[model samples]
Target: MEESKPVSYYIPNPDDDPTNERITRITNKIKIEDLIERSKRIKGCKVFQLEGRFVNLFNEAYQAYILGMDYTTVSLCALASERLCYDLIESSKITFDGRIISNIEKESFYRIPFSELVFFSKSIGLLPDKVAGKMMKLNNMRNVYIHPSFKRDRSDPEKLQIKPESDSVTALNNLIDIISGFGK
Candidate 1:
């Protein structure tokens, strides 16, 4: 009978292992710094993206104004206005829930009103009544947008000659100024 050879199994040593404590410590140190730097870069990118998005929204609102599309113009203006309000609240370190000013926390003092977000801005001393009035007009335009029947004549595709009121540009520009002030 032939003698059978015994197989030897390889066992890794924990202490002298290449992937052991020493390497782990070095890797962890590098990972920590790398994670922090990555976080900072991400934050910077987020700020840039947010600014770009805000600018684009503003530009679209302006273009809608030029095109005399009242509903579209006001809709874009309201969205950009709301974004500006939220950004202001965030930068001010004010704690509130909701992604939009219209949906802010119900229990907080900073709670925004569904119909009078401009009042919240006034309460915060960020805007005067004159400025708030512009927002109110935009709010009215928002209502007009939501309730299409209120201005059905303008909505008719065949009524292409129907033009939005001249005041639309003024209202949008006022909103832009109000929001831009917050960034400064």
Candidate 2:
């Protein structure tokens, strides 16, 4: 028989009270408005980066089409990565192999595996088959961006033609709403 894994738990530290000086030192000293602004700024940056990648994919596909090259794979993958990143940020967790993960390594947040993400998304009611169709389109684009072969041809003058026509941005906005719910 296989050994069962122990359940993990997060307990608050008795010695680490909010009034502690050490805790205060590490915590934000800024106003609430400043924190909100910062959060918005970070979110905006992520969205901007995603858009830039999408643009690159579209441009690459266009160029490839013009040159009669098969660039669909690369272009599609880039768009997928962008969408995956957006989903990851919205969910605040990474999924893999049917497992919903919340405590991934700090550095690997952006490199979450798609299979896991898809599984978790389905499990959490955050992504259903109908919505997943839209997500799949984005995920396909991400695969192309991460693959090395596609990266090499990014600088080529050939352009890919992809347009943003979905409600992904609105969907992502809902994440902010979900996160805000935690404070209630």
Best by lDDT: 1
lDDT for residue 17 in candidate 2, whole number 0-100 = 69
Q: Which ten residues in a row have the lowest lDDT in candidate 2?
A: 41-50
Model 2: residues with Cα > 4 Å off, grouped in runs: 1-52, 71-75, 78-108, 125-128, 131-184
**Which RMSD does model 1 reach against the true structure?**
21.6
Give me the candidate number with maximum TM-score: 1
- Error in Å for residue 64 of model 1: 2.9
Which 10-residue window of candidate 1 scores lowest in summed lDDT?
A: 39-48
Q: What's the C-alpha lDDT at position 48 in model 1?
A: 31
